[model samples]
Target: MKAVILAAGYGTRLLKDLQGADEQHLQDLTGTPKPLLPIAGFPLISYWIEALRGGQDPIDIFIITNELYQGKFKDWAKNYPFVTVISDGTSTNEERLGAVSCLQLIIEAFSIDDSLMVIGGDTLFYEDFHLQDVVEEFEVLYRGNNQANLVLSYTCKDDETKKYGIVETDESSRIRAIKEKPSPPETASRQACPCFYLFSRHTLPCVKEFLNEKKDAPIDEKDAPGHFLSWLVTRRPVFSTSIAGRFDVGNLESYRLCNKYFQENIRKLNYLQ
Candidate 1:
């Protein structure tokens, strides 16, 4: 299987938040990309590399980044021989290809004919997340239906519902529909879907079809991966697996919280060991 980490975002929000910060902060994060941000004494994307490296199936990792940050990613990837960094030929967020387009680019560029694991470059799961377990569950689902794809969802507060793509699943955990940032009253489901997904090889062509149909649409409609998932659940057999939680490092506050959490968790683990 192949894993693609979508890191093409320019981290404009984070940069804006860092304005007027101390000299140390500015020097540390001025040109740093989101995925390359230091978390718990390690690069943010390196955590994903450690998690995915020793899995049963040999997985090749591909990171797609913008031209502005491609050099940084390539430098960080030197320590990880298995990772391939690709530039989407975009220097700024405004000119960058959307996440859906990035995914499609990796698909066509790599000629991937196998199951693909799509993960958000700026997001990470909680301790309860086990990659092997999730892959195994996806394998079982794939056995039952070759077109089945798995997505990760976590319960969020009602007020926070508008910030994420809420997934409504049936009793059997099959995704019924995905509501993209719907108001709390608009949907009863509080299951916020993250960017982690395992797509079966049989359903790979649907991604191209989605892009083709949305060719004339605005960038907002095709930018976030949730839009693609919201469009896909209806046409494909997508299922949901509940995870403990996820950290989406969008701005400075969120990044600080994620870093603190990881630092504490790592400290506790070392103490226990």
Candidate 2:
């Protein structure tokens, strides 16, 4: 399987938050890309690299970043021989290829024909997250039906539902629809879908078709991967699996909490060994 890490976001909100932070430890984060921000003792993206490397599948990591920070990612990737850094040729936030576009770009640029696994570079999950398990689940679904696509979901607080792409699933747990940041939600389900997804190789062409259909539309049309996913569920059989939880480093409070939990998780694991 191949893994695509979407790290092209401009981190405008994160940078803005950092600007007002009084903590000395977080001061250096003013100009840093969200993925490159340090957590525990290493860059946030490095934890993903470590976790993916620990997985059973031989996943080739493809990190998609903007031209502004491509060199930074490239430098950090030097020790991980399995990783390759690619720039979307956009120097500024306005020029960025949206997450969906960046995903399609890496797929085309790398000529990947295998089952694809996509994850957000700025997010990490609880210690129980196993890439191999997700890959195995995808393999089972794909073998049963080649068109199967999988997405990860987690239950968040009811009030927090409006901040994420809420996925509504049928009784069988097959995803019925995805609602993007709906205030006073359009659906009753609290399944918040993160950026993690597994797509069978046969479903790859559909990405291009989706993009082509929205070529002239506003960038918002393709900005969130959830938008594409919402459209995708209508045409194909997409399913969801619940995870313990995930930490989205979108703001200062989240980053602090995630870093603390991650550090403790690592320390506990080391103690157990």
Candidate 3:
């Protein structure tokens, strides 16, 4: 399977938070892209590279970044010869092609016709996350039905439902509907879906279809990949696999927390070893 990493976001929020920050370590992050930002002594995206490469089966990995950060990503990618970095030709936040469109760009550019693993470059999961398990689950579902797709979900508190794309799943974990940022009373299900997805080859065409349908719609409709998945659940068998949790490095605070979590975990792991 091929993997596509969406790193095209300009990270305006994070940059804003970094401005005038007192932390000495954070000062160096002024112009860094979210994916390339240092986390636990390593570039955030390196964790993904290591995990994907560690798998027994070889997989092609592609990273999509904006023009502003293309050079940085390309330079970092030199360490991993297997990775291909593509700039979306967007120099500013306003010009970005959005996460879903970036995924489509990789699809069209590479002419990928196999199952795909799509991940948000700024997102990472807790220690319990095992890419192999998710891949195996998707493989089983795909073998049963080629139209099946998989997404990672984590339980969120009722009050936190409004901050996420809540997924309602059936007894078999097949997603019935995806409510985008609905309030507590809007849905009983507390499963919050993250940006990680495994799409079957048969379902790839639906991505283009979704884009075409939303061509004239607002950028919000096309911006987030979750919007596309919410629409896809109605037309395809999109299932959810529960994960421990996920960290989204959208702003400075979240990035700091994510970095601290990894740093602490690494220390504990080393002590045990």
Candidate 4:
């Protein structure tokens, strides 16, 4: 299987939050992107690498970044020759191609044919996250039904529904529908769908189809990957698996929580070593 990590985002929120930080601290982070931000004394994206490396299935990791941070991502990839970094050729957030577009870009650029795993570069999970288990689950479902796509979700607070893309699932764990930041009291399900997904090779061409349909739409509509998946479940079969929890790391608070948990807990794991 192949894995694609979407890291082309500019991390505008993170940079804005750190605007008044001390000059040295701000200067240190000015050029550094979120995926390269230090966590547990290493780049934040390194955690994903270590976990993926330990998985049962071998994966050729591909990282998609922007022209502004291509050098930084390339330098980080040097230690792990298994990873390939590709730049989307956009420097700023305004010119960014968005996550869905970036996925399509890498898919066509590499001509990926096998099962593909897509993960948000800024997202993290607790120690319970086992890439092997997820892969196995996806394999089982895919073998039984080639059109199946496995997505990960975590229960979120009801009041926080406006903060994420929520999903409703049937008794069999098949996704019924997805609502992006929907109003509460609409659905009893609080399954907050993250960006992690496992797609069968048969479904890859549909990604390009989605982009083509949305070509005339605003970038924001096509930006969040969940939006594409929302449209996908209608056309294809989508399954959901509940994870222990996930850290999105879009803001300062979540970033600290992710680093602290991984450093104190994930770093001490026997398998991780």
**Pick by TM-score: which candidate is best?**
3
lDDT ranking, best first: 3, 1, 4, 2
Q: For each candidate, give its TM-score against the true structure.
A: 0.96, 0.95, 0.97, 0.95
When 1 and 2 are scored with lDDT, the better candidate is 1
Candidates arranged by TM-score, highest first: 3, 1, 4, 2
Cα lDDT tens digits, model 2, 1-273, are 888999999998888899989986687778789999888878988877877777655779899999999999988888998899999999999897799899999999999898888889888887667766787888899999999999999988878878999988999789988888876546788889998999988888889999999999899889888889999999889999888889889998899998898777876532122
RMSD of candidate 3 to the true fold? 2.1
lDDT for 175 in candidate 1 is 94
- Candidate 2, residue 146: the lDDT equals 94
TM-score of 2: 0.95
- Candidate 1 residues lying further than 4 Å off, grouped into runs, are 267-273
lDDT of 1 by residue, 1-273 (tens): 899999999888888876746667655687788888988888888888887886866789999998999999998998989999999998987897899999999999999999999999999877777888899999999999999999999999999998999999999999999988899999999999999999999888998999999999999999999999999999999999998899999988898898888887875422112
The backbone clash count of each candidate, in order, is 0, 0, 0, 0
Instruction: Judging by lDDT against the true structure, name the best candidate.
Output: 3
